[model samples]
Target chain A: MGEESKKELTLSVSAPSGTSKEDHASRRTFIKNLAIAGAVIGTNALVAKKVASVVLEKDPQRAYLEDVLPGDRVMMAREYVVMTDEEKKRLVKTLIENYKKRLG
Target chain B: MKREDKKTTIEKNIEGSTRRDFLKKTGSLSVAGLAGVATLMTGTKDAQARVTWAEWFQTNYRLMTEEEKREAIERLEKRYSEEYGKKVTVDGRPAQKNVLFGYALNIQKCIGCRRCVKACVKENNQSRHDPEIEWIRVIRMEKGKFSAEDMDKGYPSDYGIQVGGNAYKNAGVVLEGQHYYQPERVPEKDAFYFPIQCMQCEKPPCVKVCPVRTTYREPDGIVVIDYNWCIGCRMCMGACPYWARRFNWGEPNLPKEEMNPDTHYLGNRPRMKGVVEKCTFCLQRTRKGRYTACVEVCPVGARKFGNLLDPESEVRRILERKRVFRLRVDLNTFPKFFYFID
Candidate 1:
């Protein structure tokens, strides 16, 4: 496979009519430079898009601590899980009833 | 045949193969395998294939050498910083000499506000959403006792024998307690709060039952779990009398903005799925001569923490002056946490 690829490369280098070795080298360099420039511009554009999104963020606004209701704060728990008021009330009732039964 | 010619003849006779080709192929294969392993070991950002591969092979925190411990902490810090979108520090501070930590809670004064529970979750960086994890749980117990006025009241049901009861209510009856109790406001007229957390037992049953030996009591009397070493067998959860251990039932959902960047390796650091975590007495703060988050945030000053070895410490004073008792003393766990009634 290495020999075949080397033979193909030699054939291509020799087949170009009126194209000097230096001309071929210069053309290869130009293509390489063009690729590098394209890559840089592409990367910059992507980065700019990301920065724009961050700068002009469309995320939903969050409530300030003072604005949030006490009841809501009690429910939110700073992301911790908490039972709903109804669930808690139900459980409390059951607990009181159990105690009442024990008393009886 | 001559020896050289015989060797040449044997090589020619072997169908579709040569000695050089075999060596070359095997050599290239070994080199490729080594390069692949090197890439994984050195790490790459492709697929964000970071320290996880190396992390799986790490030894238990107790067994790691100083250098290994530093590297592990650095690895974790990098991973957490990348994951949380902030600089995260994973502290590896060991227990201090001659400092046995103790905690005392004024059960009578707790208002059932559960602020300590929330503060603990915030400071410890517990899972936020799905498997919401809070180290402290405040239990509401309705105040009930015998009354001299209720001597002839019958039972609510007809079957059971009648004990002492008031006309409309019962006497000498205490409810088991409620963990899901949430009121419009706390400090109800008929209720008192009892908050429970890891007692940091002197002889932790959790440590005894842990199949992987991942959880252990530190010299400072703070029981901690090496989350990485835990096999998620949950034997320790069953063995704990306090019901303090919480299992990560699913992947933890800690948001980047809410994540606590300051973390201790065995204490309040963000945990992975399938590991059992519990209160570590907030060793991250406590070991640094600061109070636990619960103690710091207790509105009623009900929670107290200090060095048990120091007689001047608040915990020691509480133990000496206040009517203090450890929970489940019959279990012989010798928990460092004390409940005091003023």
Candidate 2:
């Protein structure tokens, strides 16, 4: 496919903007198209990674820190993933509880 | 923030688990894969032997075996030597057995010269880039009228000189990032200087908040960070009430001619973009029985540092003989740093 067509394909098939059955269906379609696009562009790993990073950054799992972290430097650390207060607390608490239970 | 009195806090919560299970408990196992992939993709074999699964998965310093500690130091030394094009020592210097570090600054003797701040940047290998990094911030405040709000104005307390907008011949001072800089003279008659850095708290909030356990207190009671192990998460920065931690927004720019070769694994090693850094009382020098860069450079000899445990040490004498106070006493951080008057 031509460069312009590939760009159009990416835009048209992007992950849905909202939660709905239709959006889920479109999201699946987008993932499939994304696979094809990666295969086409993966010949140049650097270019593919650059494009992939832009997509990866939009992932909800990644946005957890940037969303709730209260600081002047909001969105500055979007590129780096940091565990949130809630996540760290939950993880450590659960781990410790399990450890205590196992020991007892 | 985890209170100092809290028993069985996160730091010791994994005591019941085995090493392998503890690894899983910390969720390092799940994240290890991500860390491994990250190291491989972004920094594969950087500086000879830096980027590897083995290095990425290495346990925390406190948990590491003697052999592991040796290897860790070796890796850091090798990596830094290659990066700086010279022999760099990354010491794994443990705190002295009987020594507990403490600092006392004589606010009366302080001239607000900011000489300590300059020395600190060079000693700590701080980033001298667009988002300039320095671990020390000297706050010049009015003697009696001390409101943190006045810090932003950077003006003479009595003058009411509005910086930038007012048409005064000398429109106050132009502070960069709330850090007082280049006022021609320090200790403006009615002003007193407070230079702040890591307090090396007996119960450091930063250490408690670190999810990866990359920062910790040494036996001799100095707080330090492992740059290699730090995941570039700024959680510690947020936890620090003093704002002691600094993050490199981009690759640090250290000129070859200007770079101080003396370094420690937990202290002054050259840092990449993202990792958090803070003062370690200049562990590279402190371990060798030398004073910190701040203490050595203070023009007025206002800074005092020594083994807090030694009855004869200057710091101990200051604690006994001088009128001293700590920052944020209500927080009960029990900061090693003290402000004193002669």
Candidate 3:
């Protein structure tokens, strides 16, 4: 909405003396029209602005490895939902071997 | 006339000799005799009226000056030691001097045993005549229903029912929902026991409410009442939400033999009539760098106590690790005492 009209509408709605039938009806109608027009144009304009900004922005995820600290460890493997007996045994064997190598 | 004159002359001569004798004794008798009479009178009054300073002034603790308090304490200690057959110091030095204490309890673990209640009475030098006078009272409650209103209603009733000129067991009308005290059996299915005592609140209401400022919070968070200073207003008793305070309606009826002698300044020194008193968290024992009687006697290891200020203290550790709760968080009293369900 135009700034002048928006100010006028706000004043009309909040004015203490605006309890008369005519004043109340007019204020209600103005508010309803303002809400509808603002919703349609506001959503599209905001979305278009956001899309343009996103296209211009750099990807943050690409530098994930570089962001990690020296002592920090990362989970490299996928989290297993269901594992077979053989897979479990193999995982245990790998862990044991890693522990022994680290210790030695 | 001549005979009478002769008799008069003889009497005069005898009186003259007596006067001479009295004159001779007057120098020796005047000062010495007066001094002797005055000394005798003063001694008799002193012996006859042997009223203590406290009795003479009708002074409660708050009125006593430092010198007066010291003299009173000395007299009490001497009297108690003589009566109790030990060197019983009725008032030890203030607990701030190399003495600290802390207390904790697991509300979930307490089984409404009431053993702690009895133990505290013995340990704290409470009057046996009225066991209710001292340190602790274990309140039995059901879980999720620990309000005071419920417990008051649930207290058992005795309806004296007689049969055949004598009352028999279960003979009369049995009241439904009445429960008797049983040492072994738990009070409720989901029973929770909260042993209420002086919180030793960081901002103690009792200390604040005292008109004479007779009660005060020590540096180590123990609230102490000067029994001599308290004017028996019972304002502290009213201010305490936990009902931990008690008034000495009469001189404490303790047997001389059973009284605990190792009294701290803030702890169980025998209180005179017309004053308020409560748990000092066993300041007599604990403030001397010892554990509270209740804490040491807990069978389930439910109670824990330590310095909250020290990072390594058990109380600090519990506050850090456990979900501990005080009785009424809304009051903003800042109670040092805490209860943990687990």
Candidate 4:
């Protein structure tokens, strides 16, 4: 029965009347290679997803932080501390310039 | 499986059961259910299984008794500590006596650096991403022109609403202020900055509009919201003239390492979704005699905060000496926040 089924499979795969044997063989090989490549790609995607989940589990907040825009991430900026004398003077000078133009 | 056989089976079971037997069965089921619940309450350290259950039923912070407040704080501390992998304290400090808090911002001195805005986010433990929440908003306004052409164009000359400014130019600092201007350095050429936050109004419109009565002014003159009792109706957001209130549209995205462990119950504790939060004058720190984060971080000493009642306090000094004004004074919100010029 198995041999009979194999014979049927071969018949189904057989090229049409006008097709060359070389073209048919190459087409079969191409179909087989495509299926194998697809399986590998799918497996890799699944494995990568699993690894991401494990990483996310280790630091749950990383998932939440991942979606944050670079501009919105205040944590990455230099933390504001009490002003130094030089910094305060520079700011005052800038303010004076701004107000002078407004007044004029 | 037939309808008649099913009815017969149910009727026989009902008829066969004696009153004593029924009572025994029900009582045993009740005991089993109670046991299962008790196990769930005590057997797991999961915050959802334990803390959240109690938190949902807890009374408002304003209504909770001393012992109840302590228990609530303890529960919060435990949950936060577990979640953040560090010790977290939720301060439940009451308002200090004879201490009405007030804030003053020097508009002229402000350079539009946005340091105070960022500082407030860090100190308040506001949502870090998705919906990036900051209590303070710095508005940059261009210096308006008072050209003669604008004067004639705005009045009966045009058929519009007849508001002051015309198509040619505006009279003063026009209402058109840019909120998201990114400059290489602050105090950009001809722009002035106006920073605004919760005014902690003596008669806050937000408090008046809140249906749940979850937000109210404390004895220390700070307007605060009891987040748990807030229904997230967003009526407060609409009522506020300063646009001070923020609604948590989604679950707040606060990271663990970035989370400020020291938090006030009403001020900066990590908030859940479906709650309204705003500036509380850093009650967790202010009540303990520390300045609000914005005041501390202002680069030009542009921000000042203190007890309004004290004559020597910086806020009172500003009111006494500086040319000061509150925003929307005609609205009669009677804001405790004041803007001043040096």
**Tens-digit lDDT track for model 1 on B1-342?**
255446445534542243355557657867976887677565465322678776888999999999999998998999888888899999999998767788889978899899998999999998886666777777665565565566566555566655446544432122342555768888888776767788888778999998878998777778889998999898997688777788776668898899999999998888887788888888889888899899899888999999876768898777666776666666777677877878
Write candidate 2's Cα lDDT for A1-104 as tens digits. Answer: 69889677654543232133355446556755775686567558878788887765443322322322232122121222223445434433443343345344
Question: Which portions of model 2 miss their true places by more than 4 Å?
Answer: A1-104, B1-54, B145-178
> Which stretches of candidate 1 lie above 4 Å from their native place?
A1-104, B1-48, B151-177
DockQ of each: 0.01, 0.02, 0.00, 0.01
Question: Candidate 4 chain B, which ten residues in sequence have the lowest lDDT sum?
Answer: B168-177
Once fitted onto the true fold, the runs of candidate 3 whose alpha carbons sit more than 4 angstroms away are A1-104, B1-51, B54-70, B83-86, B97-101, B144-180, B186-188
What TM-score does model 3 achieve against the real structure?
A: 0.55
The CAPRI quality class of candidate 3 comes to incorrect
Query: Model 2 scores what on Cα lDDT?
Result: 0.69
Q: What TM-score does chain A reach in every model?
A: 0.38, 0.23, 0.28, 0.39
Q: Which digits, one per residue and each the tens of the lDDT, describe model 3 over residues B230-337?
A: 788888876876566776655567787888888855578766666777888787766566778888888887888876545577775666556566655456576667
Worst ten in a row by lDDT for model 2 chain A: A71-80
Rank the candidate models, highest lDDT first. Answer: 4, 1, 2, 3
Off by over 4 Å in 4: A1-104, B1-45, B145-177
Per-residue CA lDDT of model 1 for A1-104, tens digit only, reads 99899777766755442244346456556755775796699679979989996786432212111111222223212221223445334433443343345344
DockQ of 3: 0.00
What i-RMS does each candidate reach, in Å? 18.7, 22.1, 35.3, 19.0
